[model samples]
Target: MSRARRTLSATVTLALACTTLTGCFDESSPHDAVRDFLVGWQSEDYDLAAGRTDGERAAVRKALANAKLELDAASFRFKIKSVSIDGDESRADFSAEVDLGENNPLWVFDSVLPLHLVDGRWKVRWSPSVLHPQLKEGQRFAVDTKPTRRQPVVDRNGASLQRPQFLYVAGVIPSQLGDKDEEVVRRLSAITGFAQDRLLSRIRSSPPSKFVELATFGRTRYLAMKPKLDTISEITTQRQEQLFAPDAPMEIVGKVSALTPETEQKLGGPQRAGDSVGQSGLQQAYQDYLTGSTRTRVITLDLRTGKESALLQEWPGRENLSVKTTIDRAIQAAAESAVDQAEVSALVAVDRSNGEIRAVAAKGLDEEDDGLAGKYPAGTTFSIVASDALIKAGVKPTQRLACPAERTVGGARFAEAGQVGGPSPTFQENFAKGCVTALASLARRVDAAALAKSAKAFGIGQSWQLPLQSFSGSLPKLDSDADKAKAISGQTVQVSPLSMALVAAAVASGTWRPPVLVTEPSSPDPTAEIVPEPPPQPVALDPKVRTALTAMMRAGAVGTPAQTGSGRVYGVAAPAGDEGSRQAWFVGWQGDVAIAVLARNHDPAAVAGDFFATLHDPS
Candidate 1:
């Protein structure tokens, strides 16, 4: 052959070889098709995935719709593990890591997808099982969560804090009310004492198909007005348990109710509608311990039979545990009775020997835990720290001091109710008389750091790691002479009743012991041993200072009209002229108990004496 014929033949052969190789590489394999389909499905591209399936595209779309509804707000991620193919058939194995919620365990499962040849290309075989095995047509994935029973709160004496009580829940179904929604709400408000406008607004904002709660009432109160409530249309009532506390010192033990939107977000999980959760106080603080664990299971629901079958993953909930607190019933009752006469009053008593909080009582207060965390100007009650600082600074109790009518510090004047004209009174006598001028005059004598250090020795202005929230009081930095005077005289310092009581306890015991509320576990676990927290480092005081302080307080308690024979009560009232409101504070120690009483619009000495008198004679 000639050179030109050979060149043409070689070029045509090379072109055919390149075309054949391109066709072999471009043709879709069963394994590649299955992998691509899985990628689309995992990415939630249901439209793309359904198109990659066989003639059952409608079925695939339906299954995807059901899955979207079941998953709801949950987030999930998928991974294609391996794809195996043999001729016209293929199998794609995959796994999904689903996030149910914070309270629920993460759900991880593996599934397989079956693919077959359709015409000339491979396509996935659509079925509910492709999402999860054991799921059939019309069946969907659902999570069934069963929460454990709520445990009870008990006192130190093992008495149940909660009592069984009946309550009526009133609500309205907006759809059933139709056009009479406003009228029905007005009638319900009239019968139940709920706000008419608020109830109407709630009904309007709620979905027409949902029931909006109006109010809750005691069973007896609801029953007496049942006839009047019945006259309103679309009104509904449901009876349920409402926990009550007849013997509790305060209303901080807490209550439970159906989860609200706010609570649900704060405490995330697979919580269904109507799940009860703690709403306040100790119940809210120890919700996880009180409510225990929740049983979560992924189930395949049969739409036709209304039955459910578990899909391999199941978790059993643990039992709830009770919470035990250190509270003496007798002391709590006495404390409650002591402040019953005042509109706003609080009292705290601690065992001087062990620092165990025995009682905490308050009335007409809005804050939690008997207002132990409430802040107020220390007033003359803070004189305890002033006395300590003075004694530590070598000021003798017998040292004669002038009790002036008024003294000025840091551009603020300090005065007392009854100031002596002469200057013959001793330091002990001046403190007993609640002489703010005398204490203010000596503010420049002691170092500011030394005074603050002395105050912290009594557990004031110290950070504590406690199971429950509390305020130990705070002492601001005294940078000026006037600030020091105000702090020493209790005019600028703030304190809680608990901190004041602890001051008295420390004075009585000569050492500060951190207070403890929980002595033993409410729910004992045989397998788990309870570990006791180490005691706080002791803050020791000079025995001479404690003795002198005790003697001074006793002397101050003398001649008071409300003084009782059981114990001496030393206290002072905040000057009414300086501040708009008057607060009386009394702190004393008797036998092994140290007590502090704070009353608004009442005499602290009188209230303290009355409380001691009641303790002496329970008849």
Candidate 2:
């Protein structure tokens, strides 16, 4: 039986009761009894309604209570349409409206509630039909659902990206569980919503080698629950890998996880369990467009006969529509193949012209998005900003700068990059070669305010209208000379791969616009809110600075690893650390596409090289 929320009043007045019925003389009229009974039933006060009914009051109360669950009702209302009275017997014709769950149509019908006068009072003679006209004795209402087929999330060319993700069992190796068995059991029961006794029994009868499966989850669900299970040593879980490339693109394309109850309630009402649902990425962002349409059948089941006796209502499910994205299939495939197998690496490619993010791929699903929002020192990538500042200040790309092994500016020495000097290399050449000390020396040319202003112009410390979560480059007030030096060279700066990709796009294209992952959010008219009608234009860079920066990057990529064989791609690759052990970079594009490959602990130049190589090659 469903829990009655006490939403309706239990009392009824003689005037109101007599209006619908023909004969009623006073408050003691039998019409008042029928009124009270109908009011109680409509309000879901089962006990109050049952008391005014005759013939096995408890059984009648139960049938009334069971109506909500049997019909999966969101709402139930009863109205007295008309009544006929004959001596001691009366027939109350009422309108019954049983509302099924969300997306399904309402079930409406007319039924007669029988009543009789006894000892100067009237009572509703309750029967199964009193609850629902079709429901007979020992029959209940039931619902049947046809699972929605998920449509594939596609790329710019309409290539499918949706695929089956692995299911993981979150359980314990019986022997390895040891002393924490009780703790594991309790936690698993809570996580899985399984009964405690049933789960405890299963835990007790499991083999050591065979993992005692407690609960199975899709990749998205398992990853979400992994943190909660970390402290429990006995709770063992196998890694959930994607069938493609060790894993499907999660932080970008998104993944399907178990349909959670909390999410279900928000989606309208409780839905059937064990269905894979979009947990994040485009799958979640465009949930309404992807799998919102559903088919539902509402019927009255003959509980004693164990068969559906009548069809109360039917709502047809429509085919799920596909979600077209900004991702390029070729670029996504190439970038996925280029991710470093040894370390957590990420790549983000965006259109330089309009800032449409074309591809995002990552290896190792870490807590933070290493590809999109992961924050790290920008390394030599900061040179792009420094170059912007210096070039704007009349510093030419061909101007020869100092060749220093180490520099002590503002009392803080910057010797992190060992030595990057090549026979009086030009400022642009040194900056392109991942120069550290030279950049520190050039920090004297521009003050902290100028640097911050230039960085801001590059979209640092800015908000994105984009849907995905990302970290815009952070540039605090450059307080001291040391701060200026470090910030100029990127030793103390924090940036994400996505933010850097936009930075590269700013340099590649004349202007920098916010990134758009979902190209076609809505069918005919794209979502005005997400896709922004009259889309935010790319912030234009200074013409002179853009020209100088472009040429410098081309010159810098001369013999560097970021240099592609096609030579159509021009970018910079730089690493940073005390002993150069912390290899990091901000590498991107010169053409229509601007890319960023982010990683910590190793230089991702090789990954960047492999990515560009694929783009230039014809399969």
Candidate 3:
């Protein structure tokens, strides 16, 4: 869009028969002077062009330089179209193309270069017409940008995710402050925790009758501080509602703030003082598509009047293009509500059929999007992958394994199996009971390499297609028996809640596909259309391993806290590592949706049960 090309038909080459000592057409020939004038003008060497012209040198230079700045040109090229001679005068026609970037199509046209004879030498008799056919003596080129309507980010169903939320806005009308303005501002700052000088400055610069907002607070917080705020005579308060994104912890919905010097560069063109722009999450990632392009008009301004005089060309921007996402708003709210009691928690749900994400809910101290990226030892959850590794090595799911309060394997001690399962618990029985000892012992049935390979097959540590800070599961090198034991017990192994969700998805769908959050965006430049992302690569699970793992988890859930999930759910609860207090976790799937939950200071099994039960009712 910022480049230009010379039209081949407009190119004119004159091979004059006459030659001077300069080895070109003779200087006296009108064609020679026209050729020299064209070269100098095209190169923007106004001095040389004026030398071959009868125009004022400074005026010619200023006009040529002004055109480049007015167009904000990236590149401008000129080509000689034709030349003719009549007596001592001549006429030279040329094509000019100026590239105005970010605006579709180049500014291209043809204008005449008037020539005359001065003594025996041919010279161009330049005038305002030489620059443009319609340009007047005191006219200049100007560009007008009209921004198109910004589009909202919507879910797959095109449902608006934004809802109205009210806040308390505290301010004062500058005219009412008068001599007490500084005193009033100081008192307001003390109550509101805002800078006194900053508040005073805002009030002074604002219109005398206008309300100068100094601070804002949530409803509850404002109510608590209202008593103190009332002490200031000039203080005022107003409740106003603004559109806010859905109240979910994942931040996938994003937030917006006004344009600032720091953020102005984020937009493509000159920014206004208060332009809205995305600051984080999907909103920031897809800002260009959401904001769209601006309509551009190339016009002329009467230099003397400093006002628009004529229209040259106009191009409209693509508008009303929505940025689509895979988030299910209802599901997200439900997920967040289910884990509301935890001090810190993360829960992610995915569609079992495809990798499209359904929800990414986290709360409290899980600021790092723990659901998407907080890496923690997965506890007994890694058993899914470890089980697959052993199963491939020919270990039976029903093989009886000892579940004791404490056990040791490969020189590493393991505990935390609170109680034994039944009279004779099998490997599956121990697994459901959150048996760290029994599972760690199984590390002997297969080599360490099988664990890594099985982990890969489950999409753990694979490439995640999301444009976010996320972690795929990672297994430590099993260089020693102690490493294998810890890895097998799910301690010393770190994985995110998202990693567990995909693992559950693999079990449910039998093929693990990378997760997707956003779709392709429409671009302003037609030829600059963005390349569509490659479809997620699917890692097919082994039929034997999948069948064994599914059965093992369903039967195993019978002896653990997660055993409460309405009998219809198939998942497993695992104990995460903590020195003083342990976190809770449930990683598995039910029906067509796979889920993973990790909660601090709460029961993982109970959280999972509550989540599924709520999904069933959703009331």
State how far residue 315 of model 2 sits from its true place (Å): 5.1
Full candidate order by TM-score, most accurate first: 1, 3, 2
Clash-forming residue pairs, model 1:
none
Question: Residue by residue across 400-488, what tens digits does model 3's lDDT show?
Answer: 88777777776788776366576567887777766887887877778888888888887778866566678887888898777887887
Query: Which runs of model 3 end up more than 4 angstroms from their true locations?
Result: 1-87, 90-111, 118-126, 134-140, 163-250, 266-275, 300-311, 318-320, 365-369, 422-424, 520-536, 556-567, 578-581
Q: Residue 373 lDDT in model 2?
A: 73
TM-score of predicted structure 3: 0.72
TM-score of each: 0.75, 0.72, 0.72
* Top of the candidates by lDDT: 3
The TM-score leader among the candidates is 1
lDDT, candidate 2, equals 0.68
Which parts of model 2 have CA positions greater than 4 angstroms off?
1-36, 39-48, 54-66, 74-116, 125-144, 164-251, 258-269, 284-289, 297-320, 341-344, 364-368, 416-423, 447-449, 522-536, 577-581, 599-602
What overall lDDT goes with each candidate model? 0.68, 0.68, 0.69
- Residue-pair clashes, model 2: 0
lDDT of 2 at 308: 66
